[model samples]
Target chain A: MSDYNGQAGDGMNWQPGLRESYIFDRNTIEEIRRAASQGIYDIRGFGAKRKLPHFDDLLFLGASMSRYPLEGYRERCDTSVTLGTRFAKKPIELKIPITIAGMSFGALSGQAKEALGRGATMAGTSTTTGDGGMTEEERGHSEILVYQVLPSRYGMNPDDLRRADAIEVVVGQGAKPGGGGMLLGQKISDRVAEMRNLPKGIDQRSACRHPDWTGPDDLEIKIEEIREITDWEKPIYIKIGASRPYYDTQLAVKAGADVIVLDGMQGGTAATQDVFIEHVGLPTLACIREAVEALQEMGMHREVQLIVSGGIRNGADVAKALALGADAVSIGVAAMIALGDNDPAYADDYAKIGSAAGFYDDWHEGKDPAGISTQDPELSKRLDPELGGRRLNNYLRTMTLETQTLARAAGKSDVHNLEPEDLVALTIEAAAMARVPLAGTDWIPGRSKDGF
Target chain B: MTTATDVEVVDLATTPLRELNQRLHDGAAGGPLRWRIVNPNGAHAVAVGVDAPFEIEIEGHTGYYTAGMNKHAHVRVNGNVGVGCGENIMSGTIHITGNASQACAATGRGGLVIVEGDAAARCGISMKGVEIVVKGSIGHMSAFMAQSGALVVCGDAGDSLGDSIYETHIYVRGSVEGLGADCIEKELKEFHREELGRLLTAAGADAKVDEFKRYGSARRLYNFNIDHAGEY
Candidate 1:
């Protein structure tokens, strides 16, 4: 018999010479070309675009004949969450569990910052500040704001510290855990420069660690200093990228954190090396149980509230996070999307930037057509804060309703009532990471099969 | 918390360090303009984040982050200090009579910190707008990545001086072990000499301007470039 191989194109039979490399695929080839031409690593905005095991890997079993369900229409499913109850004199009380994650005014438009604040306020949740110091517009619009203390210490001051409702000491971000923040020269506007106390139009690389302190012991003193600075009123949250969740969680708790904000690999960034963003940190689902176990081992599960972030998309993700032991969930990219990022309406404008609407993530370029990520005056004016805020509020409400529907179906009167027993994993990898039973089977892969 | 007002000193040995800091902060807006902190006994974050215009003196030793983020307070420590003394000070002064450990005046912005004794590594590291003067020598990595400030060392400087330095000015009277990447000796013009003289007067260090050499950023690495990888 004559040897014959089929010709290949898009999804066609693989041809001999035209076969794609498993190691160096077409996308990989393009990246190589880009690196060869530019002589620099790929620096881009947004989180890891690669697919990872996320909340979708897990599913909830609805109440059946054996387990009774609650009446969805008439019954109530509570969504309220309280954080920072362990230490702060004034703990954050939220109407919903979902909050707006810190997106810097330098990374986003001032209008966008205002919009996020307005939306969070309308939803009765808290909004957070980012690398750049507090903006008047941001503080004025949001009733409750969490000020972030970063490695750079750019515009860190006492007035802003006292003004903040809470203080989050950022150890690392999910996008680049061990790496520092990178702000391209392109995004450094006059206002952004003034806030960061750097020269305008200079590429800024922030520190990877704090200048003054290091380690858990030093962190305890640092936390105390901030508490003293703020008169022990505001909650001090330790936000860390999920690399060693068990050890990091223990260290953060030991460091005197009122709350722990854990971010997974799917978290977004304003700007960072593409390689670092995709390579570092654990996925959100993989991190939760380890963190929960650590907190539980320390007998501080609910005492020190846990807020999970990174890759949170829909109400399903929120419910799954809560089910896995997170007290609350924070959103960044989703909130940006709700603020008109990557919308089909701006498809033509995105094309001008050499991208499609949903495909555009060059936030570091500061040429966002949606006006949410850009610092340009003309581009930023496109977004009216009031309208954007209303849209975000609508999205938050929709998510809350979806969560409530699922919770009622699961017979959970309070959203926090859902537990891991109600969950089943679709994949073995997920079953192992989430420590949940495989669907239609009681096997959790790593755990003993014995029921006792 | 012991408040012995008769001696005009707040004793940290008897008073909780937290209460002392709280008093320092709560009184900053409208508290005592001047006070003495006795028996500091190496307490961390003593007199930190004081916003009000006050003059406080610490009698003994201190631990990490002493007078950190000081806004409007003038604090003086009679004895030695641990790591990160006068970190992130803003519009105030921190004077240490004895030696200081690592990261002295780290990230200080718009304040003056004078260490009579030598400072360990990373003095004035990432300094913003603060002015620091050291009577004795400074350890290695001094003024690394300093953004905007002035670091004056009356004695010698250790290795890797001003590595990856920014706009901050450095003046050293004694020998320099080595200059770090992108750091070069600049001409000590009349302008710099006069500024050095002023800083010297502030630190109370008696050093001739003619004996000192100045160093600053070459500014080559202000923006990223592949050719400058060796420098980084």
Candidate 2:
């Protein structure tokens, strides 16, 4: 099948010159063939590969005559962020606005989890645990770890909850919001089986909903039970995929969350159907304003911290999300990249698995040459946690420095001081979603004249 | 407020729920090991999250998540209990004299839950390793997705007794309305009968093991299949 090199076109009247039909493109034909033969939907890892309106569509408006810009080298731009300030006695204090998002021990290697902990600690930030229970490698290395409470409740015990620095109740994931997690028998090792309390080598299916409770009312009780179990010491966060941000954020707030973690469609998954990842949740840019508006409407914008994730790469994206009113940001796929995932050095090994270096995303296969996403003992030893941690730290430092550069250009001393007026959209779709004016125009599409 | 040797009485009418839980967590370090809570009045999260080994008794009704996530504690509620009673329990003993609400003992792991009266819907839902015995009937969707545990019911069960169950052993003496997808009735083997007899005797229940039927996972849906693509 042909790759996207200007092959697809709108015109399809017995197309000549190798011009492919837009609707029935080469990829679509290949997918149909595979489905007809295999009779199953294609399941893969990674986030949405399709292009959408992103932070790149928004440009920062530097200071000119009306506004004064700060000195590039001399001015200090504060990047510290304090999360979970609404209800917790002990909140997270980060040196940078970026944090490492949750990636499970089962989906990722134990060494990779260790590396993330070591790096986040070096960067003066926190790392989060994912669908699987907390492993000692991460908990022992990480200075501050946020434990996740998912629908499956796998390896969910009171001891881990008490030891966690914070708790995140996962309502849904961005890649598959209403879906459950899938771990093929190939990935469920002896440790994974024991931890999850399931049989060895049996395909595991995580339930989509919490076993005890159903909706918001039950969410309140669940949060309360967690708080009670932890003695009300740790901050409680509610994570929602970007489906209906306005209502979900409000309900999470009402459920007594100290922080809200919003993940968009571009958020990465370990293993899920390809169709659901591409079609489900809203884009990161589309949900930021809506979520921020919900928090602002409740007068809890900064009081209850908002950590936005999915498609976050560098400092510009970080600044754009913050300018759109997010308190902080979380990174998952970027962190994996920082720890040497999909690096060109393993191109030879990747090719053996029927993939190229940058194109390889079969994390669920558990044969990752980089040792980051696999459970194979031999392959896992390829990653040196210390070196991976250093690389991740360097990447995080660079992103922080880049964010400071952007903040200085906008004449701001603190990163959080950047406002919506400092940015303009390069496209109408982005302008409508980000609620920012289009470049060289005073109008934001679909916004009312009264600005309400 | 009794002294050192006596059972301390905490009246929910006068005291706060948080205070009672805190006292329970204190775990006889400063007071008596036995506690009697009065005027529970259907309060949610009553006597929850106590990891310490203590005997807690509630005289009146309690609300959601009562004795939830319990560890090593023995709790008894004389009146009715609300939703998610003894949920995610690690190790404990919970006895309820009155009927229980929905999701009772849901996701409980390694515990013994006994309900003298009927249990509402989704009873023992997703139970990991807990042993639950209900003297009366259970509502619909009981033991749904229950993973390694045993649920015993004396009276009739509602619709969908064991939907999508995994490894959980269900023994019902009375009639079962129906079995759910991926759940089927299994023959009562000798070991199962002995296990049922032991569980019944442990719960102080007077029931014959010969009249009960066992239901468990059919194991057909244990792995994914291309032919059953529509199920997903």
Candidate 3:
């Protein structure tokens, strides 16, 4: 026994339970084993788990010597953002720059969707309907709601289109840019099945491409059709995953979109193959500059609003995105967490389902202990929409307050005024990706800019 | 235009199409039911959002989404129509005397569409509970991913007919260029023949039900099978 547990650096000693390099880590080994045993890849929810260069690698260059900083409490730091002013008769006006990202009624419980709408309305921001289309509960709760026109067009109708404050034409998603949407059999409730016009207890995969149109040229005609239907009252938004952001953005602008939503790899999905979620699309940090460059080249940077999403957690991430030239930022996973999606209170239930409290990602299974993702009546009963709404409102308020604090520290009267000049990256990768200068120096790496 | 009786004339040249649609929508369930639209020269979204059971006649060619989101209205297009004719309809019928562009009767929930001439690509795509009859040939990928509907094509079908279809009954009279992934020819039994015959009769098409072949989903790709992942 003593020999089996030999100490490190001991000569001629047999080591027990030794592991391979971190490159072939435990999670990787587990995934491979699971795939091999099941004869299928793992499907899960949430964003990319692997670490990448994120907003944490960049820091605000707070006002000093030559710059002037506003007093924290006394000075006002406005955080308002307006979306879709380019073509729509009524552009959405928000009290904060952070909006709620689209999360479908099927992917989430009805209570959760209603709570999100309530919270967003309370925060004076907007919420969006996901692939499954608009629910009456969400519509009643949300003051300003953007309806998504996905490839599937599940539950889509002209009445709902006209009822929407804005319309988002979802060309692709961040988790799987080229991939279609998947709602497992377990998640398809009777109501959801009826809404989507699919059979109950069958795994539904949405179309990867639009049924009518093929390319961007055809897409322009489709957009015109939508505009004609809505009488140009609603702002038409084009959302694309962060693959070929520059080209996609330019195409979206040329298609006469009032807004563009660029989602990065870090964005959450309800259910998708782990491979697609991890391997597809660019990181949020790397995609923003290219998207902004497209808008700048077209001379429509601020004219056609750009909303950045994927991996937005807190005020710092929002400020960083806005600083990188995003008109607004949208959040999904963070909002779910705020609504008690992975609460530790359900740790015992989570363990029963073969997942831990914080690591639970089986959203497609419809066995969510926290009541946010599950369609099961007993499980959904666990969440109180009013309480969840309050929690989300609190979270939104905190993010807004923190953003204002940071803007004041940077001497920006408005949150949108915090530009790339006030930011520096701690790493070369981040510097190159964010197109900002390196800290303690003046080098942007890729291009020759004034900062260098 | 001369012999038609008991009709309300709406000239697109004089009144805006939106205003006409608004008036049509404002009328109650059993109000004035016959309307004749004149001079609709390739205009888009003409006579949209009609909920009542009105009988509307478009005299000439129209652009995209002619008579879209129609409910209970009997809309007749005398000439060729562009993309998405009678899209997302709820009830009633739409008859096109001439050809229809891509995605005719797309995502329609109820009602019937009769294309007297050829229909282009993706006709009846994602159609739900609607019945469409095409007298002439259908282009590529017709009825692609149709959820619940019946598309009866009197003539030949182009490539990849009923690709990724879902529960929709397709009856093609002539040859099919190819079958799409997971879409295959199904046994045309007596019940299917009767269904096709009824649909044809409703659309006033002069095609025999026995001459057509049926196509549907094989149900192989319904679930997330690892073997099928590559095809997707």
Candidate 4:
């Protein structure tokens, strides 16, 4: 037995070698060299690239011998959601649980904002305003609009606040929590400059924290002030990143917030340092339970609605989030993709800018070939609002159908009835993090009286 | 008692602010030429979103956001305001007879805010094109991250004044505790004195214009300088 030493038959028998560079992988070496040469951190759009525990780790247990399943097409599974019912004089009602997350008009074109509004309106959902301010086009097209009051207060006005159906006071973002917003000089077009009241070609950096308040007590006063200004007709939502969801939710509820918007690390940003996007904040899977626990502890589980965002891509993700105790879910990057971002039709244009179809993340450069993120007039003309709106409507309808299908299989009458009992984790890490029973076992990893 | 002009008097105690504001906002073209609000006992959002070319007279103290988003309206508050006295004023004039709380005239785009008494912290913050004239001192971090326009303080400024400021010009009659990042004292030239004098007259200040020292952007941190990212 010559130990199979014959290499000629195996086509030269090259050994499979692993690169011995932990600190200098190809991508990491490129980043290091780029940072050293440019003397600045790399800034780009999109969410985190590093993988984390997500909804895919959990599986729903369909109806079996003990439970009877509902008919998929016959039995009704309602998905309607009502937000801001706690303190708002008028709460927002949506036919579906999915919403369009905030993306600023400055980061996106006017046509794109209009498209988002039209699509969300047609789909019977709500759209949000992002950093710079609300546009009239967005307001006119959207049936229900959530106006964001950011730290910058760029185009904030009393009239606009009154006009909005709901108000979202943004404390932090998932991409760069506690970091200010950055819109480079190239993106600051004339209209954007006029709206934000900045010079046309100057870089605009928004404030990291609100200038008016320093603590939760002052936030209470500020919320009250907004309430007084709007006569309490609109719902006030507090949006916080997933850094400290438990305490943030508690404080927001204490400050009399009608709704809480929790964005995880996977949430997309128009522009931020690549390092912050990947390294900061908690995973979406880890954020939900803590926020739900906080709300449950305060006896505000259902009284104050919880809207979760950050990497929600489809109906299963929506169902999983709802099962984990979220009232609704919002989407940003997925919506843009459905609206024709990173399309193959613009591959040549992307190639001209040293990028490819699915890898383009230079939204801050103001050269988007798909016309969704850029402010260029010619590029913006490429996107037709009516067509984009139709595509978004189709996507939303599909997601709703998929969610309803899952709910029917689980023998649930309503989508909101999906509970943690119906889900099981595929891995021990997920079981411990999501606090669900591991696959066929009756045990959750960390549920014992003594530490596991 | 009706004034000579087209004056509509509304007592805050009787009329709801929503109804009154709706009437005022909806009827801006056909509404009264002037409005006089009485018995405003620290009411919030008094005379807010008044877009028409009119005049508003508040007889008593107002809460937050008094005359906020005032477009083409002249508002006069007889007593002190709680906070954000003239926030986001587009184009108009807000004259506060008494002291102002934090963030007075914040993010004002195009207007004039005249504070008769002292202003608290973050006064004239993120101000753009709106001239804010304070007759008395301003608290810490006044004019913080101001993008444009001019902030005039007749009295002393608190700590870290004009921090990370942009093109906004800060003129002070009294001492400044310290200059913030990228903020420096500029030589008060003849043109600056003239500008300060005009602002003083507009704000109804009796202080000498030449006694004020000017501070402005040193042109640092205007672009994304890596060395200044720490300040950001």
DockQ-derived CAPRI band for the predicted complex in model 2: medium
Q: Which stretches of candidate 4 lie over 4 Å from their true place?
A: A1-15, A18-23, B1-63, B71-74, B187-194
Please write out the lDDT profile of model 4 over residues A1-452, one tens digit for every residue.
Answer: 11111112233433466332444444565678898899988899988867788889999999999878899998999999999999999999999999999999999999999999999999999999999899999999999999999989888887889899999999988888888888988899999998887778778888898876677877886787677667678999999999999999999999999999999999999999998998999988888988999999999998999999999999999999999999999999999999999999999999999999988999999999999999999999999999999999999989998999888899998999998988999988888877889999977877866767
- Please give the ranking of all candidate structures by TM-score, highest first, separated by commas: 2, 1, 3, 4
- Candidates in descending DockQ order: 2, 1, 3, 4
Q: Which ten residues in a row have the lowest lDDT in candidate 4 chain B?
A: B1-10
- Name every residue pair that clashes in candidate 4: none
Model 3: residues with Cα > 4 Å off, grouped in runs: A1-19, A449-452, B1-34, B188-194, B227-232
Residue A154's C-alpha lDDT in candidate 1? 81
Q: Considering only N, C-alpha and C atoms within 3 Å, which residue pairs clash in candidate 2?
A: none
Lowest lDDT sum, 10 consecutive residues, model 1 chain A, at: A1-10
Give the per-residue lDDT of model 4 (tens digit) for B79-196: 9997787887888899999999999988888889999999999899888778999999999989998988999999999988889888888999999988888899999988888888
lDDT rank order: 2, 1, 4, 3
Report model 4's interface C-alpha RMSD after superposition on the true interface residues.
Answer: 2.6
> Across residues A146-262, which tens digit of lDDT does each residue of candidate 2 receive?
999887788888899989999999988888889888887788899988888777777778888888889998889878877776768889999999999999999999999999999
Name the lDDT of candidate 4.
0.88
Tens digits of lDDT, candidate 1, A266-376: 999988888998889998889999999999999999999999999998999999999999999999999999999998998899999889988788898889999988898
Candidates 1 and 3 compared: the better one by DockQ is 1
